[model samples]
Target: MRFKLSTVVLPSVLLLGSACIVEAPGGTSPEQRRAATVTQIPPLSVRNGANLGRKVELVAATVQPGRLTPGERATVTVYFKVLEALEEDYLIFVHVEDVGGRMERMNVDHKPAGGLLPTSQWKPGETVKDEFSIYIPSNESPKALNIWLGLWDPRTDSRLALTNPDQVRNDGRNRILLAQVPVAQ
Candidate 1:
């Protein structure tokens, strides 16, 4: 019996071609691969006032390796300033998101700017240095990580001009600052 080339070799060639495609280890599908890639990045770190807006300005950011256990965690430090002095109350948001869609919020103090700068009312000439330490999980699959910082203006009872269009607008709203940091292992 003679074997036809089309019938015998075609299927073998196709099977070998498909096998050459690399797949992620441990049953990670294509979608999971893409998601993993997105999560490997570290959080953003701003270094200058130019990256900030009128309301909340980014002074600087720093990070250090905290623990190297099952899940990697890094202590992130950030500095910011609030322009203009207002009697209204405000809240700052700092957070980190991992590749697996896990997010963690950083603890920050918005009162008595002692560790920061300019404890009194936010003045034009005065500068504030607010710091926050954030932890990033090690199970993040070594992908891109996202970090965000926002300023919420709770001055509903008072009428004060809020700076930073991205954080707050003239319509009496709030705004936030965004930063992207790349991570590698």
Candidate 2:
């Protein structure tokens, strides 16, 4: 029996074509790229991204690709200026909450300046640049998200009170307003 080229080779060719492997654009997979990009700052150190008190002042919060979606991560950069000299080192905390100040997620890290640089070492007029990436959970995802920043002590499990009561949210722990992230498709 003669084998027809179309019948015998077509399917095999198509299968091989489909199975062909394509290297990730730069030879790194999605996860690899994500790892390389990393959250600009480590999660262990966190400080108020805003000026919530005399100790430190939050100068700005910038989110890249402002549009957030479920399961996607975005980079957030928080800028701070030292106000008054700090006596001791402190931990920084970031809260991602719903519209009403109800927290959906929170990140408590060392100072945005990094572990080596603590709040105590920070100098007045100095700038603190902190950045991180957060992956939005599908179940907890909302149309809009709010970010707040503050300081905390892990040993006492207490959050540093903000000098400005006006900036405090529902709990009044003094989570300075970072920004409102609007979710887009």
- The per-prediction tally of clashing pairs is 22, 13
Error (Å) of candidate 2 at residue 78 is 0.9
The local distance difference test score of model 1 is: 0.36
lDDT of each: 0.36, 0.51
Cα deviation at 39, candidate 1, in Å, is 36
Query: What is the C-alpha lDDT profile of model 1 across 91-113, one tens digit per residue?
Result: 44444444346444333423222
Per-residue lDDT of model 2, residues 7-105, tens digit only: 110000000001112222323344433332323343433333345557776655555554676666666656667778877656777666665554445
Per-residue lDDT, model 1, residue 95, is: 41
Which lDDT value does model 1 have at 159?
20
What lDDT score is found at residue 128 in candidate 1? Answer: 45
- Top lDDT prediction, candidate number: 2
